[model samples]
Target: MEKQGQRCSGLVLVPCPFQGHINPMLQLGAILHSKGFSITIAHSQFNSPNPSNHPNFTFLPIQDGQTDHDATSTDFISLITALNVNLVFPLQESLAQMIKQEEKKERITCVIYDAIMYKAEEAANHLKLQTIVLVTNSAATRLTHFTYPQLQAEGYIPPKDSMLRDLVPGLHPFRFKDLTILNFPNLEALLQLIATTIKIRTSSAIICNTVDCLEQPFLAQLKKQYQVPIFSMGPFHKIAPPSSSSLLKEDTSCITWLDKQAPKSVIYVSIGSAASIDGRELIETAWGLANSKPHFLWVIRPGSVRGLGWRELLPECFKKAVEERGCIVEWAPQKEVLAHVAVGGFWSHCGWNSILESICEGVPMICQPCFGDQRLNARYVSHVWKVGLELDNELERGEIERAIRRLMASKECEEVRQRATDLKVKVEHSIREGGSSYNSLDDLVNHILSI
Candidate 1:
């Protein structure tokens, strides 16, 4: 009661399965918890996934305080629950009950839903929980999904082989052949993605992990279509305190390494945990960066190493080159790396979190989108946003080499860099006092409080 009295509100966030959704959603929740909202983050226990908790946060297992938290102001969770009908019911039930209980004792003002997690929103609707969908992808990507039906009707999507083809008209065309080659094993998942977009479009509210300035036109278009209100309160990032159990740990060694490099001299490369690449392609990209002779920080998740697993060995030449001017780690403090003075460009898988963070940091991209909507994001970055160059699916060192030089050292690179910096400033302003994102966030708060 006292904690509620101090903060006067609370939140419950449900994140979709997988690292991409969980990581960024967790970051956003933390920021909200800091802003005087008591938070509940629900996760599935089916995967036995770890929340890898932070202070005043939790994992909603069958553990203590899972459905019971009468604690202090700042509380958050990383939902690790499975996305099945059975699991979702109990989780949702628990959420409604928790909020009711909290409301009785104090207050839980809102329910934040993961964009594709339909069950969460259903639960929110049932309980009359003021709902907000958290879109971890670019607003443009949501536009793609929302616009998919139109695209399909207009002959932009065709049935190819066993999968649906995406005939992305302009610079790059997409087909089902690429889906299989890129390992989209689940057609059901694709349909769910499209379905999720339908829900988001008609949704009364949304909380995107983007700033309105970075995607001004799309944000405008989105508002024009569904004026239910939208908020872009991020690339919300912060430095870790020396005093807490951090959400993602940092390695200061990389910062020391970055210091030795010249200003805007290093390339930051991370495919994110969900992106996969073959060993042959990995070697190809390694050699590509080496040949470019640029300083780099490369994150190679063990999960990405397929056939032989992480046990698989890289060629000695690649290792020697990595040692020469590169730092390779399993995971990285991504936000910090982007904020660093040395990072000039990013070689990325074009995940939404990576893209938005890079944009907010004023860094341009060498986009090598792996699969999913990353391909879409890559296309927009190069063609629409004009903030990046594409590293297509050729799997060759020379192509990688050329793209790096063009992005990091050429006149084309400067144009991309300028656009990137301009967008970054714009996004920052949008979340500042009276900015669109800021105002939207406040409006969201008022709506929930009304509820």
Candidate 2:
């Protein structure tokens, strides 16, 4: 252990209280470890049970032994309300003091903090160490969050109740006909977002997981406005090995199965770790996948069943019909699944990590955006990236079936797949040895040393 006392580069990685954030942080941690940094990753006590987190990674559980009210779960509202430093401060302080004890031999040289965990910033400042903020989302998403006030004023956001947002300048001409964030925010939701946006901007330097090519226009604008250094060294897992994707337990079988199918012939469906669907919708989706007659793999969470009673979530008939074509699991090796030759397309929630992964894997998406900036990502995938189609937030089986068929059997799908392949090449180049991301990491390391 490269603890304090020696002159090693001791580092701490603080991810927000969520899986989406945690995923990227882990990848970066792996990279840092490969580059010789001693790493400490803090996990919320809330997520202690998850097996997906790496065992070798140092784990600091926040909110340990707390009730549900104090834990941070998948529910966005519940998490924001339940989590606080009161629940996490002890761990933070202890770790800091431990560092102090070891500073002579190998110093706790710097911090790589999550932008959401602003308290980590204070901890770094108190310790008088250089701190860099990791913004795991895309450049555009960060820019949107940062510029929410302006978007609200321009009427692009706080969108009229009838449709999708249509007014962000220099962005896709989107109209929320797809049941987007237009449900209108409750007062608390509005306030929380505003607070988060303001707090995140306070970081000393920002590290985003995106490349310059993907969102250069927006990234350039943000770089110009901020005084601190902004680096784009992302799609961080472009050629990642499938060590810890969702389907870790079953990835080998899943990929072997995919190999039996014809090339580019199957649809890989996943709605991310946190999304849940009703029984009615599940049945419809099952029927659609079956009707489309495509080889498919659908990741269904154990607790996703509706009516608060999961027994009735899947009927015997639907399951029987789709079993041969469908492979269902709580989480499957999502990255490997996407990269499979049999996986011609993807059905997803448009999560930023998922989007980047799919783009890097060269798989076209069938977007079913659920929340937050997902709608914006869906738009970019469909319009800008030219890699996928939108589910339009409609749960009907006919649309699902038709979309699958078109995605697999049409000229457009082939074109999109080809384009995705090209993008994948570019994404790989950006993260490889001496690639843009490789150099960006160097610059980041040097920046921390200078600070």
Candidate 3:
């Protein structure tokens, strides 16, 4: 155990570059730092986190050979493939250099990396340093990756429309349609990426950003599948002191607007950073919010709507409605927005981070999952957790209005709100002293030291 007033060991954290992935990795860094670990962040050049925000930690940028154009132009599979291949040598060299420099000082203990950055594990293994995999998504989502091969062999990969409504063989609460097999242009590449990421390799442990109460079943299954010690120490944002981790600038004015709204009267809407919509879907969404009775704060991320500038394609009637009851920004401080007393519901992409944030704040959701694990997360939120409603159909004004009403204004809303609040309380207990997450974090620290 780390002694009081003595720095224990140095850790190098490698985060995947996306906003959702970056937040938890950095928050984990913050938590370890508070526990007396010297922190070093080794990140890809693409979407590098700003060092100014975390002055205490050292930042090492690995050359990924990806320009801004490549990040924008390439498909998801291509980008990931490029990253996995391009980063291996550069990262190895960087770690080797760090090992040489820190030989006499606080020795580098282990490389804790995002699950997608498998190259980090290889690099650390070459140097005979310990490694840990940090899974940012829910345990249920990780289970899907572990079972992908079996799912494919069972003819569930290219899911038949006939089996869409049926539950997966062993994965309860997840229908065939709810699987994370996103419609990528290169299916083989995506499959390979999933296969590669699921391998435990030489890592010493797996750290998940989830609470035991939420996905205890799936976590248990994962424990049986992997030989390494699995730590469910999570809700990292709550465990660590808050910092600015957003790559996009957040519009703080929405919080001021939220202050004027009645308690639990506003519904916050954001589809997260990666998902994009066409002009038609955007129009439908605009009218849907306009028709719904609750005041709304919507984040229209720049370039998220295809073939149109931000809000330029919003119908005139919708614009008029915004003057009365809506506020739209390019991006929002989502955690802050969800935590505000006035936010009654969230219309989200059902990204794992978004779902956890909403649950943490006792805010229910209107789930509109776009791709990948989002559909699975949405299914769990609406069906398993009973804290949110899912919008599983095409975007239409009336449907959207009704979904919002169901989540915010209808009679069932209170039940869902209470459930969300109840879950929030459970999550709070999980992070308090002697709670599951707290103890898991302690165990994680000891495990790292043991290595």
Which candidate wins on TM-score?
3
lDDT of 3 by residue, 1-451 (tens): 4566644599999999999999999999999999888999999999999999999899999999998888887488778778878998899999899877874448899999999998889888899999999999999989878777887887778777788889988888898888888565677778898899988988989999999999999999999999999999989999999898999999999999999999999999999989999999998898898888789999999989999785579868778767869898999999999999999999999999999999999999999999989999999999999999999899999999999999998789999999999999999999999999999999999999887
Tell how far residue 73 is off in model 3, in angstroms: 2.8
- TM-score rank order: 3, 2, 1
Tens digits of per-residue lDDT, candidate 2, 275-374, equal 6788788878888998998889887766665565544566788778877777766667777788787888899989999999898888999998877768
- RMSD of model 2, in Å? 3.3
Task: Give candidate 2's TM-score.
Answer: 0.89
User: lDDT value for candidate 3?
Assistant: 0.91
**Candidate number with greatest lDDT:** 3
Better of 2 and 3 by TM-score: 3
Over 4 Å off in model 1, which ranges? 1-7, 46-53, 62-82, 96-105, 153-156, 159-189, 200-204, 224-227, 238-252, 309-312, 321-323
The digit string of per-residue lDDT tens for model 1 on 151-239 reads 55774444444553444443134343332223444444554556554475335677777766667777777676566767766665531
Q: After superposition, how far is residue 175 of candidate 1 from its true place, in Å?
A: 10
